[model samples]
Target: MKTRLVTASVLLAALGVTAAPPPVSAASLPPVSASSPPAPAGEHGWVTSTLRHMSLEQKVGQLFATYVYGADATAPSAADRAANRAAFGVETPAEVIERYHLGGVCYFSWSHNLNDPGQIATLSNGLQRAALDDGSKGRVPLLISTDQEQGVVLRMPAPAAQFPGAMALGAARSAGAARTAARVTGRELAAVGIRQPYAPIADVNVDPANPVIGVRSFGADPALVAGLTAAQVLGFQDDAGVTAVAKHFPGHGDTGTDSHTNLPVIDHTREEWDRVDAPPFRRAIAAGVESIMTAHIVVPALDPSGDPATLSPRILTGVLRGELGFRGVVVTDALNMAAVRQRYGDERVPVLALKAGADQLLMPPDLRLARDAVLRAVADGELTERRVDESVRRILTMKYRQGLARAPFVDVDEAVRTVGAPAHLAAVTRVTDATLTAVRNDAGLLPLPRADRSVLVTGWDTAAFAPVATVAASFTARGARTTARPATLPSDQAIADTAAAAAAHDLTVVLVNKAWDTEVGDPRASQQRLVAALLATGRPVVVVAVRDPYDIAHLPGVDTYLATYSYTRAAMDTLVRALHGELSPRGRLPVTIPTADGTGVLHPYGHGLTW
Candidate 1:
C-alpha cells in the first residue's frame, strides 16, 4: 500500500500537479499574522514619539541597512580596517551607524568571521551598545541581520547549528519539520542579539540549472514550497519572535543566470507566472511574512520597460503591494550586485527603490551616497516626505513587534549557550536522517557486503571533514580499511593516479558537492572526469551527493546513488547510518534531477527508494 502511494505521488509530482499530502498536514501549522502597527504608549510610545521628531536625513537613514565586518572580537587591526573600507566602502559598524544613522546592519561570513558563538555574541552586543549610545536621539535599536539560510549559505562558522537548507526540508516532506528547522535557526540568532533573520527563501526552484537558488529554495513544487515557506515564516516570527523576511519575491527559482553576477530575465506569461512563480509569495504573505525581499530580475510581462523588479513600481507597488495585498516591508536585494550597480550607480539605486515601494535599501554599494540620494530626492520633490514616512512607519512598527523597543540587549553568556545547543544539534540530526533519500540502488550496493572490505572515499572536502570525519571513521570502527582520495578536480595526471588507487580498493564511495559555482575553484569538468575514471575501474561504486542531488543526472549507468542534501556533520552521520543499514533511506527527492544534457528530468521531485 505504501509503495503504491509513493509511486502515485511521484507520478503526480512529475506532472507538476500537487502530490499526495505528507503524513503531517500543512494546515495543522499555525498561521503567522502580519505585524500589528505600533501602539500609542508604553513600548509603542517610543516609536511614535521618535518618528515625530526625526529629521528628513534621519528618516532616510532609517531606510538603509548597511554592511558590517569584524575579523575577530579584539577589534580589526589597522590593515584589516583599511581592507574593509576598500571592500564595502564603509569604515566600521560603529562608524556607519554614527555617520548614516542607519536603520540596520547585516553581517557576512567574508566580512564578519563568525567562527565562534561567543565572539559573535560579543560583536553583536558591542554593536548594539554603540547603536544605543549614538546620539541619533531616537534610541531605536539596530536591526542586526545575517544570511543564516543554513545549507549552502551558512554564515556562522562553528556553533550556529546549521540545518540542511530548504530542499532538505522539502525532501523531509513535513511542515512540522520545516517549522522546527526555522525555529531552531531563529532561536539561535535571537539569542545573539540579532533580531532580524533575512531567510526562509520562498522561491520554488523549478529550473534545475538555476545557479543561484538551487538548494536555497524549498523545491520545484509550488504547493510544497508554499507550505514549507509559510511554516518557516511562522517559526521565525511567531515561534521565535524574530523578524522573518521571505525573500526574492515573485520568484527567483526558475532563472538560469545568477543575479549576483548579472540580471536574469523571467519571460513567463501572466498565466504561467500565476501557476509557477506566484503561489509561494501568496502563501508567504498569507502567513504574514514580516518582509519580502525584492528580486533583481526583470519580468517583461509585469514591467514592459525591462527594469529590474527592485526599481519597478509596476512590479513592487502595482503587483506585490496592490495585487498580493502584502502590507509588510519590501526590502531590496543588495545594490552591490551588477544588476543594480551597472544600470543605476550607487547614488540612485536607493531613491529609485523607494519610488518603487521598497521599505528597506539593503547593502547599498555606497551607504553615504545612497542615503544622501534619498534625502535629495525628498527635498527636490522627486520623492515625497509622506512616501518616506510610510516606509519609516512600517520599519518602526516591525522593530517594535520584534521586541527591539522593550528589551534589546542580550546576555552574552546566554547567547553562547543558545546557539548550537545540544538539543538544537539533536533536532538537526533527526531531520537530516529523515532527509537521506536514495534514488538509485540498482546494484543493491548498500548495506555493504563486509565490515573488513577495503574502501576508497573521495569527493568534496578537506582531509578531516572538519567538525566530523564520521563517514570514513564509521567504516573503520566496523573493522573496514578505508582510504581517502580527496582532491579538487586534479590535473589529468593526478586524476589517473587517483583512479588507479581506487581500482585497487574493494569498494568505492565518491562524494559530489556540486551546486552553485564556488568563487575559489572550478571543479565541474574535473569531478565528472574523476567519476568516469572510477566507474571505468569495473569496481562496485557508491556515489553519495553531499551538496546537490542533481549530480546523479550527470552520472549515467551508475549502480548506487544517495543524497545527503548538505555537508553538515549531522548529514554525514545520516549517510553513515544509512550505508550501514542502521537507518532506512525514506527521504523523497525534493527537486527534479534533470538529465545531463538538461533536456529532461531523470528522477522526478518525489522519487526515492526505501529498503
Candidate 2:
C-alpha cells in the first residue's frame, strides 16, 4: 500500500501536473547538512523533487493547516462533517485534501479527545490515509500538531501524565529537568501520532499580573528561560521525534491581557526586547528548533504598523528571520483568535500572515477563503509565486525533517500503551513532588500533626476540591478526621459560612485554583475574605495554590502558603503526603509573588521551604 502511494505520487509528478517555475532566487535559504546525523536532514535531499511535482493549487494547499472534528481519527460522518464544515467554513476532510491540498491539521481536545492515545492515533492515521490517498503529486504526510504544553495548558486528556508546568520546572531550577519534561511530553505525543507540539513557551513571564502566561512560562528570568527553552527543543527533536514549537515570539509574558481575548501591545523598546523577550527564541533557533509560533502582539518599537507579530512583516520577517536567523517553519498561534480575526477578517489574515513570513496558517476560521485568498494574491501578483514556494519549501522541509514522508503511520495499540506508560507517569509524579513549593510555613506549622488534629478543607467549588479530598484522605490514613466543603465566591453569606466552618476546625486548609493568569484585578477577593474570616477565628489556616503560584502574593495576610503548581492527581497526592511529612516540599517559586501592595514579589523566584 505504501509503495502504491509513492509510485502514484511519483508518476503523477513525472506527468508535470504543475511544471516547475524557475527556482526562486535563493537568498540564502537556511542551511541543512544532508549528512547530518538526524533523519530530518537525511531526507532533506527530497524536498525540491517533491516541490517540483506539486501543482500550483497543491502548493497553496500546503500552506493552510485546517482544523477538523470527528468522533474518531477518520473524517466525521456526512452530517457531523457538515456541522464542522459549517463551523470552520470548509467541506469534508476529503474535499479539504482534494481541493486545498492542505499542509497539516491542528487537533484540539474539544473535538478529538487527545487523551485517548488509541483514539488519537486512529484519528491521526485516518487523516494521513486521506492525505496519502488523495492522489496528490507527493502524497505529503500531514503535519499533525497539538497544544501539549503539559502544565496548566495541557490539551491531552488523562491518562496522559500531567507534569508540573513551565514555572514548576523553573522552580526545580534544573535545565536537565526541563529537557526531560519536554522529552517525555514529546515522546508521548509522538507515540499518539502527533509530530509537532506547540510547547516550551519561550515567553519570559516578567509580569505577575499577566493573565495568560502565569506559570506557563519557565520563570521571570531571561537566561534561565532561554536555557530551559533550548533544552526542551533538543528533548523534543532529538528524543521524541516530534518537532517543538517555541511560542508567543517576542514574548507574551509581560502582558496583563490574553491574546485570545484581544490584541496586546508590548511597549518595550528594541533594546529591552533584546534583553528580555528575545533570549529564549534566540536559544531555540541556535539549538536548531524546527518551528516557532508567533505571538498575537504588537511591538510598536519593532513595527510602526500596529499589526500583531502574527501578521507583521517587521516582527516575523525582520526580527525572527533576519535578526535571529531562524531558518525553520514559522506558524501562527490559531488565527481564529480575536487578536487577529476581529481586526483583519478570516480571508485577509492568512494572506497577510504568509506575506509576513509565516509558513503555516493554523486553524484559520475559514479554510477555503484563506486558501483561495492566497491563490488570488499570487495570481494578482500581490504575492509573488516565489514567496509561496519559499513557504511550501519550508513546510515541506519540516515534514521531511519530521521524517513523515518515510514513516507516517503508527501502531495504535503501541500508542495506547506508550502514551501514558508507567515510566512516563512516574516521571511526572517525581516532577509534581519536586515542584510543591512552600512559600510560608508559619511557626513551623508544616508536617501538620497526623493525629488528633481536626482538619477542614474548603475550595471555590466541590469539583475543585475533588482532588483535594485525596489530600484529606492522606490525613485520614494517618488517623486524623477531615471534612471538606465548597465556598463559591462573591457571596458574602457563603464566605461567612465558610469562615464559620473553618473556625471550628483545629487546622483549616483552603484550596485555591485559578488556571489562567488573566488579570482581573483582585481575582481572589472572595478567597481573601474567606481566609481573613478563617484567620479571625484564631485557627491555623493553610492556603494551598492548586494551580497558579502567584495567587499567594495576593493574600499576604495568609501566614501558611503552599504552591502545587498543578492540580493533577499526582500533584494533589504529593501535596497530601508533604503535609503529612511523608514527602518534603522541594520546589521553589518559579516566578515572583508580588506583595499585596505590589511593591515586589513577596516570594521571589527560587523561594521555597522544607522541613
Please tell me which predicted candidate would have the highest lDDT against the true structure. 1
Once fitted onto the true fold, the runs of candidate 2 whose alpha carbons sit more than 4 angstroms away are: 1-42, 75-79, 88-95, 461-465, 488-490, 515-524
**Pick by TM-score: which candidate is best?**
1
Q: Estimate each model's TM-score.
A: 0.91, 0.89
* Model 2 pairs in collision: 73-123, 115-157, 211-517, 211-518
Off by over 4 Å in 1: 1-44, 71-74, 84-91, 462-470, 515-523
User: Against the correct fold, how does model 1 do in TM-score?
Assistant: 0.91
Worst 10-residue lDDT window, candidate 2: 1-10
Q: Determine the backbone clash count of candidate 2.
A: 4
Candidate 1 achieves a global lDDT of 0.77
